[model samples]
Target: MKGRTIILDHLNGREAAALMLDGQLEDLLIACDAPAPGTIYRAVADRPVKGQGGMFLKTPDGNAFLRQIKGMAPGDELLVQVTGYADEGKAIPVTHRVLFKSRYVIVTPNAPGINVSRSIRDEDRREEILAVVHDTIDTVPHGIILRSSCAAADDKDIADDLISMLALADQVLNDDGKGPETLVEGDEPHLLAWRDWVEPAEVVTDEGSFETHGVLDAIDALSSPRVELSGGAFAYVEPTRALVAVDVNTGNDTSMSAGTKANFAVAKALPRALRLRGLGGQIVLDLAPMPKKDRRGFESALKAALRADSIETTFVGWTPLGHAELQRKRARLPLTELLN
Candidate 1:
């Protein structure tokens, strides 16, 4: 994903359009416009019609801005410049826009679907939450869920985000301001909220040294599931060429039949390989071709082994070449790829 910076004059639609068209902004950041706060929008530029270009802005706040003009319009034209490469280092255009002064607020039910008639003061905070919510709701509805952030938030956080927005809005609102206006900006990319939510069993990384500070502080606070530091595990990568080979070693497990043990080993190794290698596409599994007496035992053992990983594996019977075929879900990267 590419990052961007934008400036807008007040809540002028024309200025927004110019920045979007010129910068070819893919994502937009609006500073103000509370009441449906933190709303992020996507700008779709219509194909040039007879030398005239137009743009349509779709925001979660149920607001849209459209512009139809052949060239630039007057009065502080939206100025947007972007730096990002796409598809073989080609410049892909993106649209960015900001609204000055207007902040947003979102009124979510205390308990989803349970709307209560409650009023919250702290105008400063209310406006801020509204603005950010309005911008974020469109793109990341699932991401920014209404948590304690709104509960007794006293609008403190709201005020903070709002005040921050106002500072940016004020800068753009100023007529004497020299540089391009920046209506809104996103925070640093880190899973602060995720850390606050899910308590992982443990967080192991290869970064070395285990001093929990800064972003990792929240991870340290988790109880029940304590976080531990350890050197990263080894990762295995898949072969790039079309043809690849996997040699299965039985090692030593005398407790189970040879065929059953072999099947279990293969099943146990599949998930690790899939994840580490970032492997996609089809995967073919060749189990040790065992005698007829062990055939049923092998199939049963394979099924049992797959259950441990919560992955579905089909026997597909046996092939003429004595190989077993199975299908697994395709993940962006396989475990083996990452491990390698």
Candidate 2:
């Protein structure tokens, strides 16, 4: 895997981080941490809106939604975690299920269970990693999940990371006396994603850009509508209101052998393109059709490529018309919103 670069843009009231791989935007994240992910805040429950099907919880940021409502009352004070970003004219999504993370693991306070990353395909390796996690940490009361990165980590590294996470978990659970609407600012959401998710090689900020990396210049050059791969192959990615559509065209490459090579290049490029743009949802890939046998090989390569991604993805197989169907769990704001 090639190392990526991180570019941080801070202006006025907004902050954003763009992960660049080979000068192309691999993963872009917006810092909307007023009530960020992993942040625990005290909120007062308000009356449930029968029309909306959720209760209003008043926190420091504002009133957020409690979808299930539980047994919360109008004056009840509760500790909640911001799960998802606020929708347009809607409350920030909050959940009682809070989880703490280290580089290789995620510890869930309320839910006590062992779960592994779905991206980890090798069942044997998954079992091996889970065994390590179970054997290393036995006293933790919270649920522990081994991240995909744990497969590459050794026993000592996992143990050290677990100890640190346990301490943080204890701290989060013991804190008291904070007023309502007060935000328990944990990690900078982007920094957590950079460290645990993307794991970029070099990070360049607006202030750091002038030093040597030419990160700003790279971002400028790579900002284009179409991505041109070697052998004159290209992927035209367009985002729609519902899902993103990517078309692979072998421009001016007439040889049959070259076309086959182009399709493989497109296979490699498709996952990278999707990751770079942060386009998730039902992804349709329209490519030059290959034989049924070849399609299986291509699908395997595609899945392997997607394993690098932090988000959850399900490859729904190819349609009769040869369009590849995929569903990726939305990880962040769309590319348009992030760029804007």
lDDT of 2 by residue, 183-265 (tens): 45645645665556534377666654422444345445435659787788887888887678878777888876655566788
**Model 1 lDDT tens row, 49-143:** 34436433223222233344445333323422121111222223223433322212222212233111134455664555555555533432111
Clashes (N, CA, C under 3 Å) per candidate = 61, 3
Worst 10 residues of 1 by lDDT: 13-22
Q: Backbone clash tally for model 2?
A: 3
TM-scores, all models, native as reference: 0.31, 0.69
Which candidate comes out best when scored by TM-score?
2
* Model 1, CA-based lDDT: 0.34
> For candidate 2, what is the TM-score?
0.69
